[model samples]
Target: MIINKFGFRSNVKSVSLSVMDCSAGMLSISLFKDLLKVHKNSVALVLSMEVVTPNGYNGKVKSMHMANILFRMGGAAILLSNRKQDKHKAKYKLQNLVRTRLGSDDQAYQSVHQQPDEAGKVGVSLSQELLHVAAKALRTNISELSPLVLPYSEQLQHGWSVIKQKIWFLAGQKGTYVPSFKKAFEHFCTHAGGKAVIDAIEDNLRLHKEDAEASRMTLYRFGKTSSSSLWYGLSYLEAKGRVKKGDRVWKIAFGSGFMCNSAVWKCITNLDPNLRNSWSDRIHLYPVEIPEVCDH
Candidate 1:
């Protein structure tokens, strides 16, 4: 049934995004962008999803337990068109995308990992140190992306701050301000990896409560949908009737390579509010407060 629904073709190259952390979704979108560039007149369907339960492992490993508690099942399919005519009917236009990978060291990779225990159940374990790694990567990614996205005033402040601190040695390596992605994009679909991650991003980016609400709501209601979490956030926006023609949307996701990936898209058409699978269906059941982490 699954095969039939997907309509497998002999010539299609099936790429599976497995074991990648939350950033996998942005990576998948970036891949779609590249494919569209190559197949300029063709249509491309991109699928992103993850199965967290299947990878759950039973062990005393505290790190793996974090994964067991964090991940949840979800998937998304996005259709892209490269034909110039598509501009008239398209729902969104592909804009700039940037991806940055840090922590290539073995220690960084091992900091977050999936391993099996005595019972032989495969599960993911994330070291507490992963937070530090994530922060470092975030800084690196924002540094590379900010100049491209930030306003000149903010960039100048960042530059002067670095110089004042006498950190000239790190001049090009510091990120003093988060890009005003919200200014450039009317909507944001940040990956709902966890409450802490979401909060950290919100604080770092100085996003308003409403700006982070969609991601937090999705995380609470659906848990971590891995690569598809951002779509769920987009669905939330659609449910609220916020997406409109010419509105730009930004998607940001983090993953295993200690990677940070971002995609910018401009909506071409107004989305119907009656769309099925909208996030509103489960919003009523979401906990008003973030739920306590379980040790399952």
Candidate 2:
């Protein structure tokens, strides 16, 4: 609609969807894929930013305190194009997008919320159980992504692993082997929502120190930029010259409403130095020592 502000016609086709918090960005990617399927040569722009104005919640709740510390002030816009000629200029090509939700579960539904208090106070509320809920959502999301990105042999191994795990569970035993996602992606760009969230993903996915470097550095330098956090991670990797042609990058985000969403992209070319973002000047200093409480 803003195109009309520049004198463009309002007759352009549109499809809009609203998703929960950080998950909204990846959800946009999902919808954009649908739009591309319907129209051959269209492009979609997804803009995401954190809301820091009209500051909500001045209370002493721990979640509010954490939110104030984690959510920073920033935004990013991503362009998705399906045009053949555009490929030469595009940085990455869309691979796939997967979204998973835990709305049916009561605990998951109440994990992160905005509600009116009995006294009529309204502010975002986050539960202590959020990590637990997020872990569940993250697992579900990765499960969906496995089929799309995993190699044929990896998928077969995963299938057998699942069956073996089921048998172990039936025998009142536990299966410790979880498929390694490292082989599926060259770089991982996860939401820098919190140190705990990143740590949980690293542990769950069996990722090593370098695997989560981009995300950790993003949080250290930018705090948590909400939906744009994934982009920040990607930027960090880019600025560090870690991305290359044909490499696969995976972005995963966790948001309120216990949602987890993922988007995968394949690099079209080596990152151009001139195209590096704001982090260019400070990239070398990052992955800095982020202490437990680096209150800014």
Candidate 3:
């Protein structure tokens, strides 16, 4: 027990929490929500920051250089409370959270790894198998999450497809059906990992180009802000006046553990188009056409 500057004695809970590697933003929110459950009517603040120093990498490996090219300094702070009084002012409600990891597999664990080069200069080396590993992790996460967030009709269709796929496998054929996430979520905020990553998600999830516009714009404008990329994508939607009351959003992210994590949020208030935020000043210039390769 201790007394704070406010002169009130209370228990201060301190936790050294981390999910290991990136995606710490989502991990922090999960932990914060869990802590709130333990302390009723409590408010929790989750702060996530990433600072990429110029000296953090020293290598000529093309894979490693990709990190330096994409990673940048960024941070986000989110406040959450379970207090009934705060409900009226709350912007969204957390509906579901699902985390998946393949760290036990060697390929997954080494997908995004830090090590020394031949010159003994340390830098993060991305494995050539990263995309494959990431896809598996995302699939596993969606399998667990779909039941929780998707509509019953969608789930039934997906289940039937899986059964048909299994039968086809017995016949030495391949078939799969990708469930439509758009039916359940009005907005999709995926991590701005890279253009390839964003494109893969948009294609696999059957999302339209407009649905991935926020993520593509974030990657182009802010680079890869690591754990906070998802928030920036959400902010892009907010600034564009795309979010509305009763809208459901799907926030997804992938990280170093070869992990995929997702959270579902239901909007409680209609957002204002004129809302000032990180993207407000330049929202008009977004959804720009990014050529296959830019040389200018």
Best by TM-score, which number? 3
lDDT of 2 by residue, 84-138 (tens): 9898889998888888888989999999977655556566778889999999998
Model 3 has an lDDT value of: 0.83
The C-alpha lDDT values of all candidates are 0.73, 0.80, 0.83
Candidate 3 local lDDT, 156-250, one digit each (tens): 88778778767845555355667899988999999788888888898889899999988888888888888888888889999988899999999
Stretches of candidate 1 off by over 4 Å are 1-9, 60-63, 118-121, 167-181, 280-296
Q: Mind giving the per-residue lDDT tens digits that candidate 1 earns over 32-130?
A: 777777776887777777876666666775656777677777888887788888777777877778888876766567667766767786776676777
Off-target runs (Cα >4 Å) in candidate 3 are 1-19, 59-62, 168-174, 294-296
TM-scores across all candidates?
A: 0.85, 0.89, 0.90
Compared to the true structure, candidate 1 yields what TM-score? 0.85
Return whichever of 2 and 3 wins on lDDT.
Answer: 3
- Measured by C-alpha RMSD in angstroms, how accurate is candidate 3? 3.4
lDDT of 1 at 243: 84
What C-alpha RMSD separates each model from the true structure?
Answer: 3.8, 2.6, 3.4
lDDT ranking, high to low: 3, 2, 1
Question: Candidate 2 versus the native: TM-score?
Answer: 0.89
Please give the clash total of every predicted structure, in order.
Answer: 6, 0, 0
Q: For model 2, what is the error of residue 5's alpha carbon versus the real structure, in angstroms, after optimal superposition?
A: 6.3
Against the correct fold, how does model 3 do in TM-score?
0.90
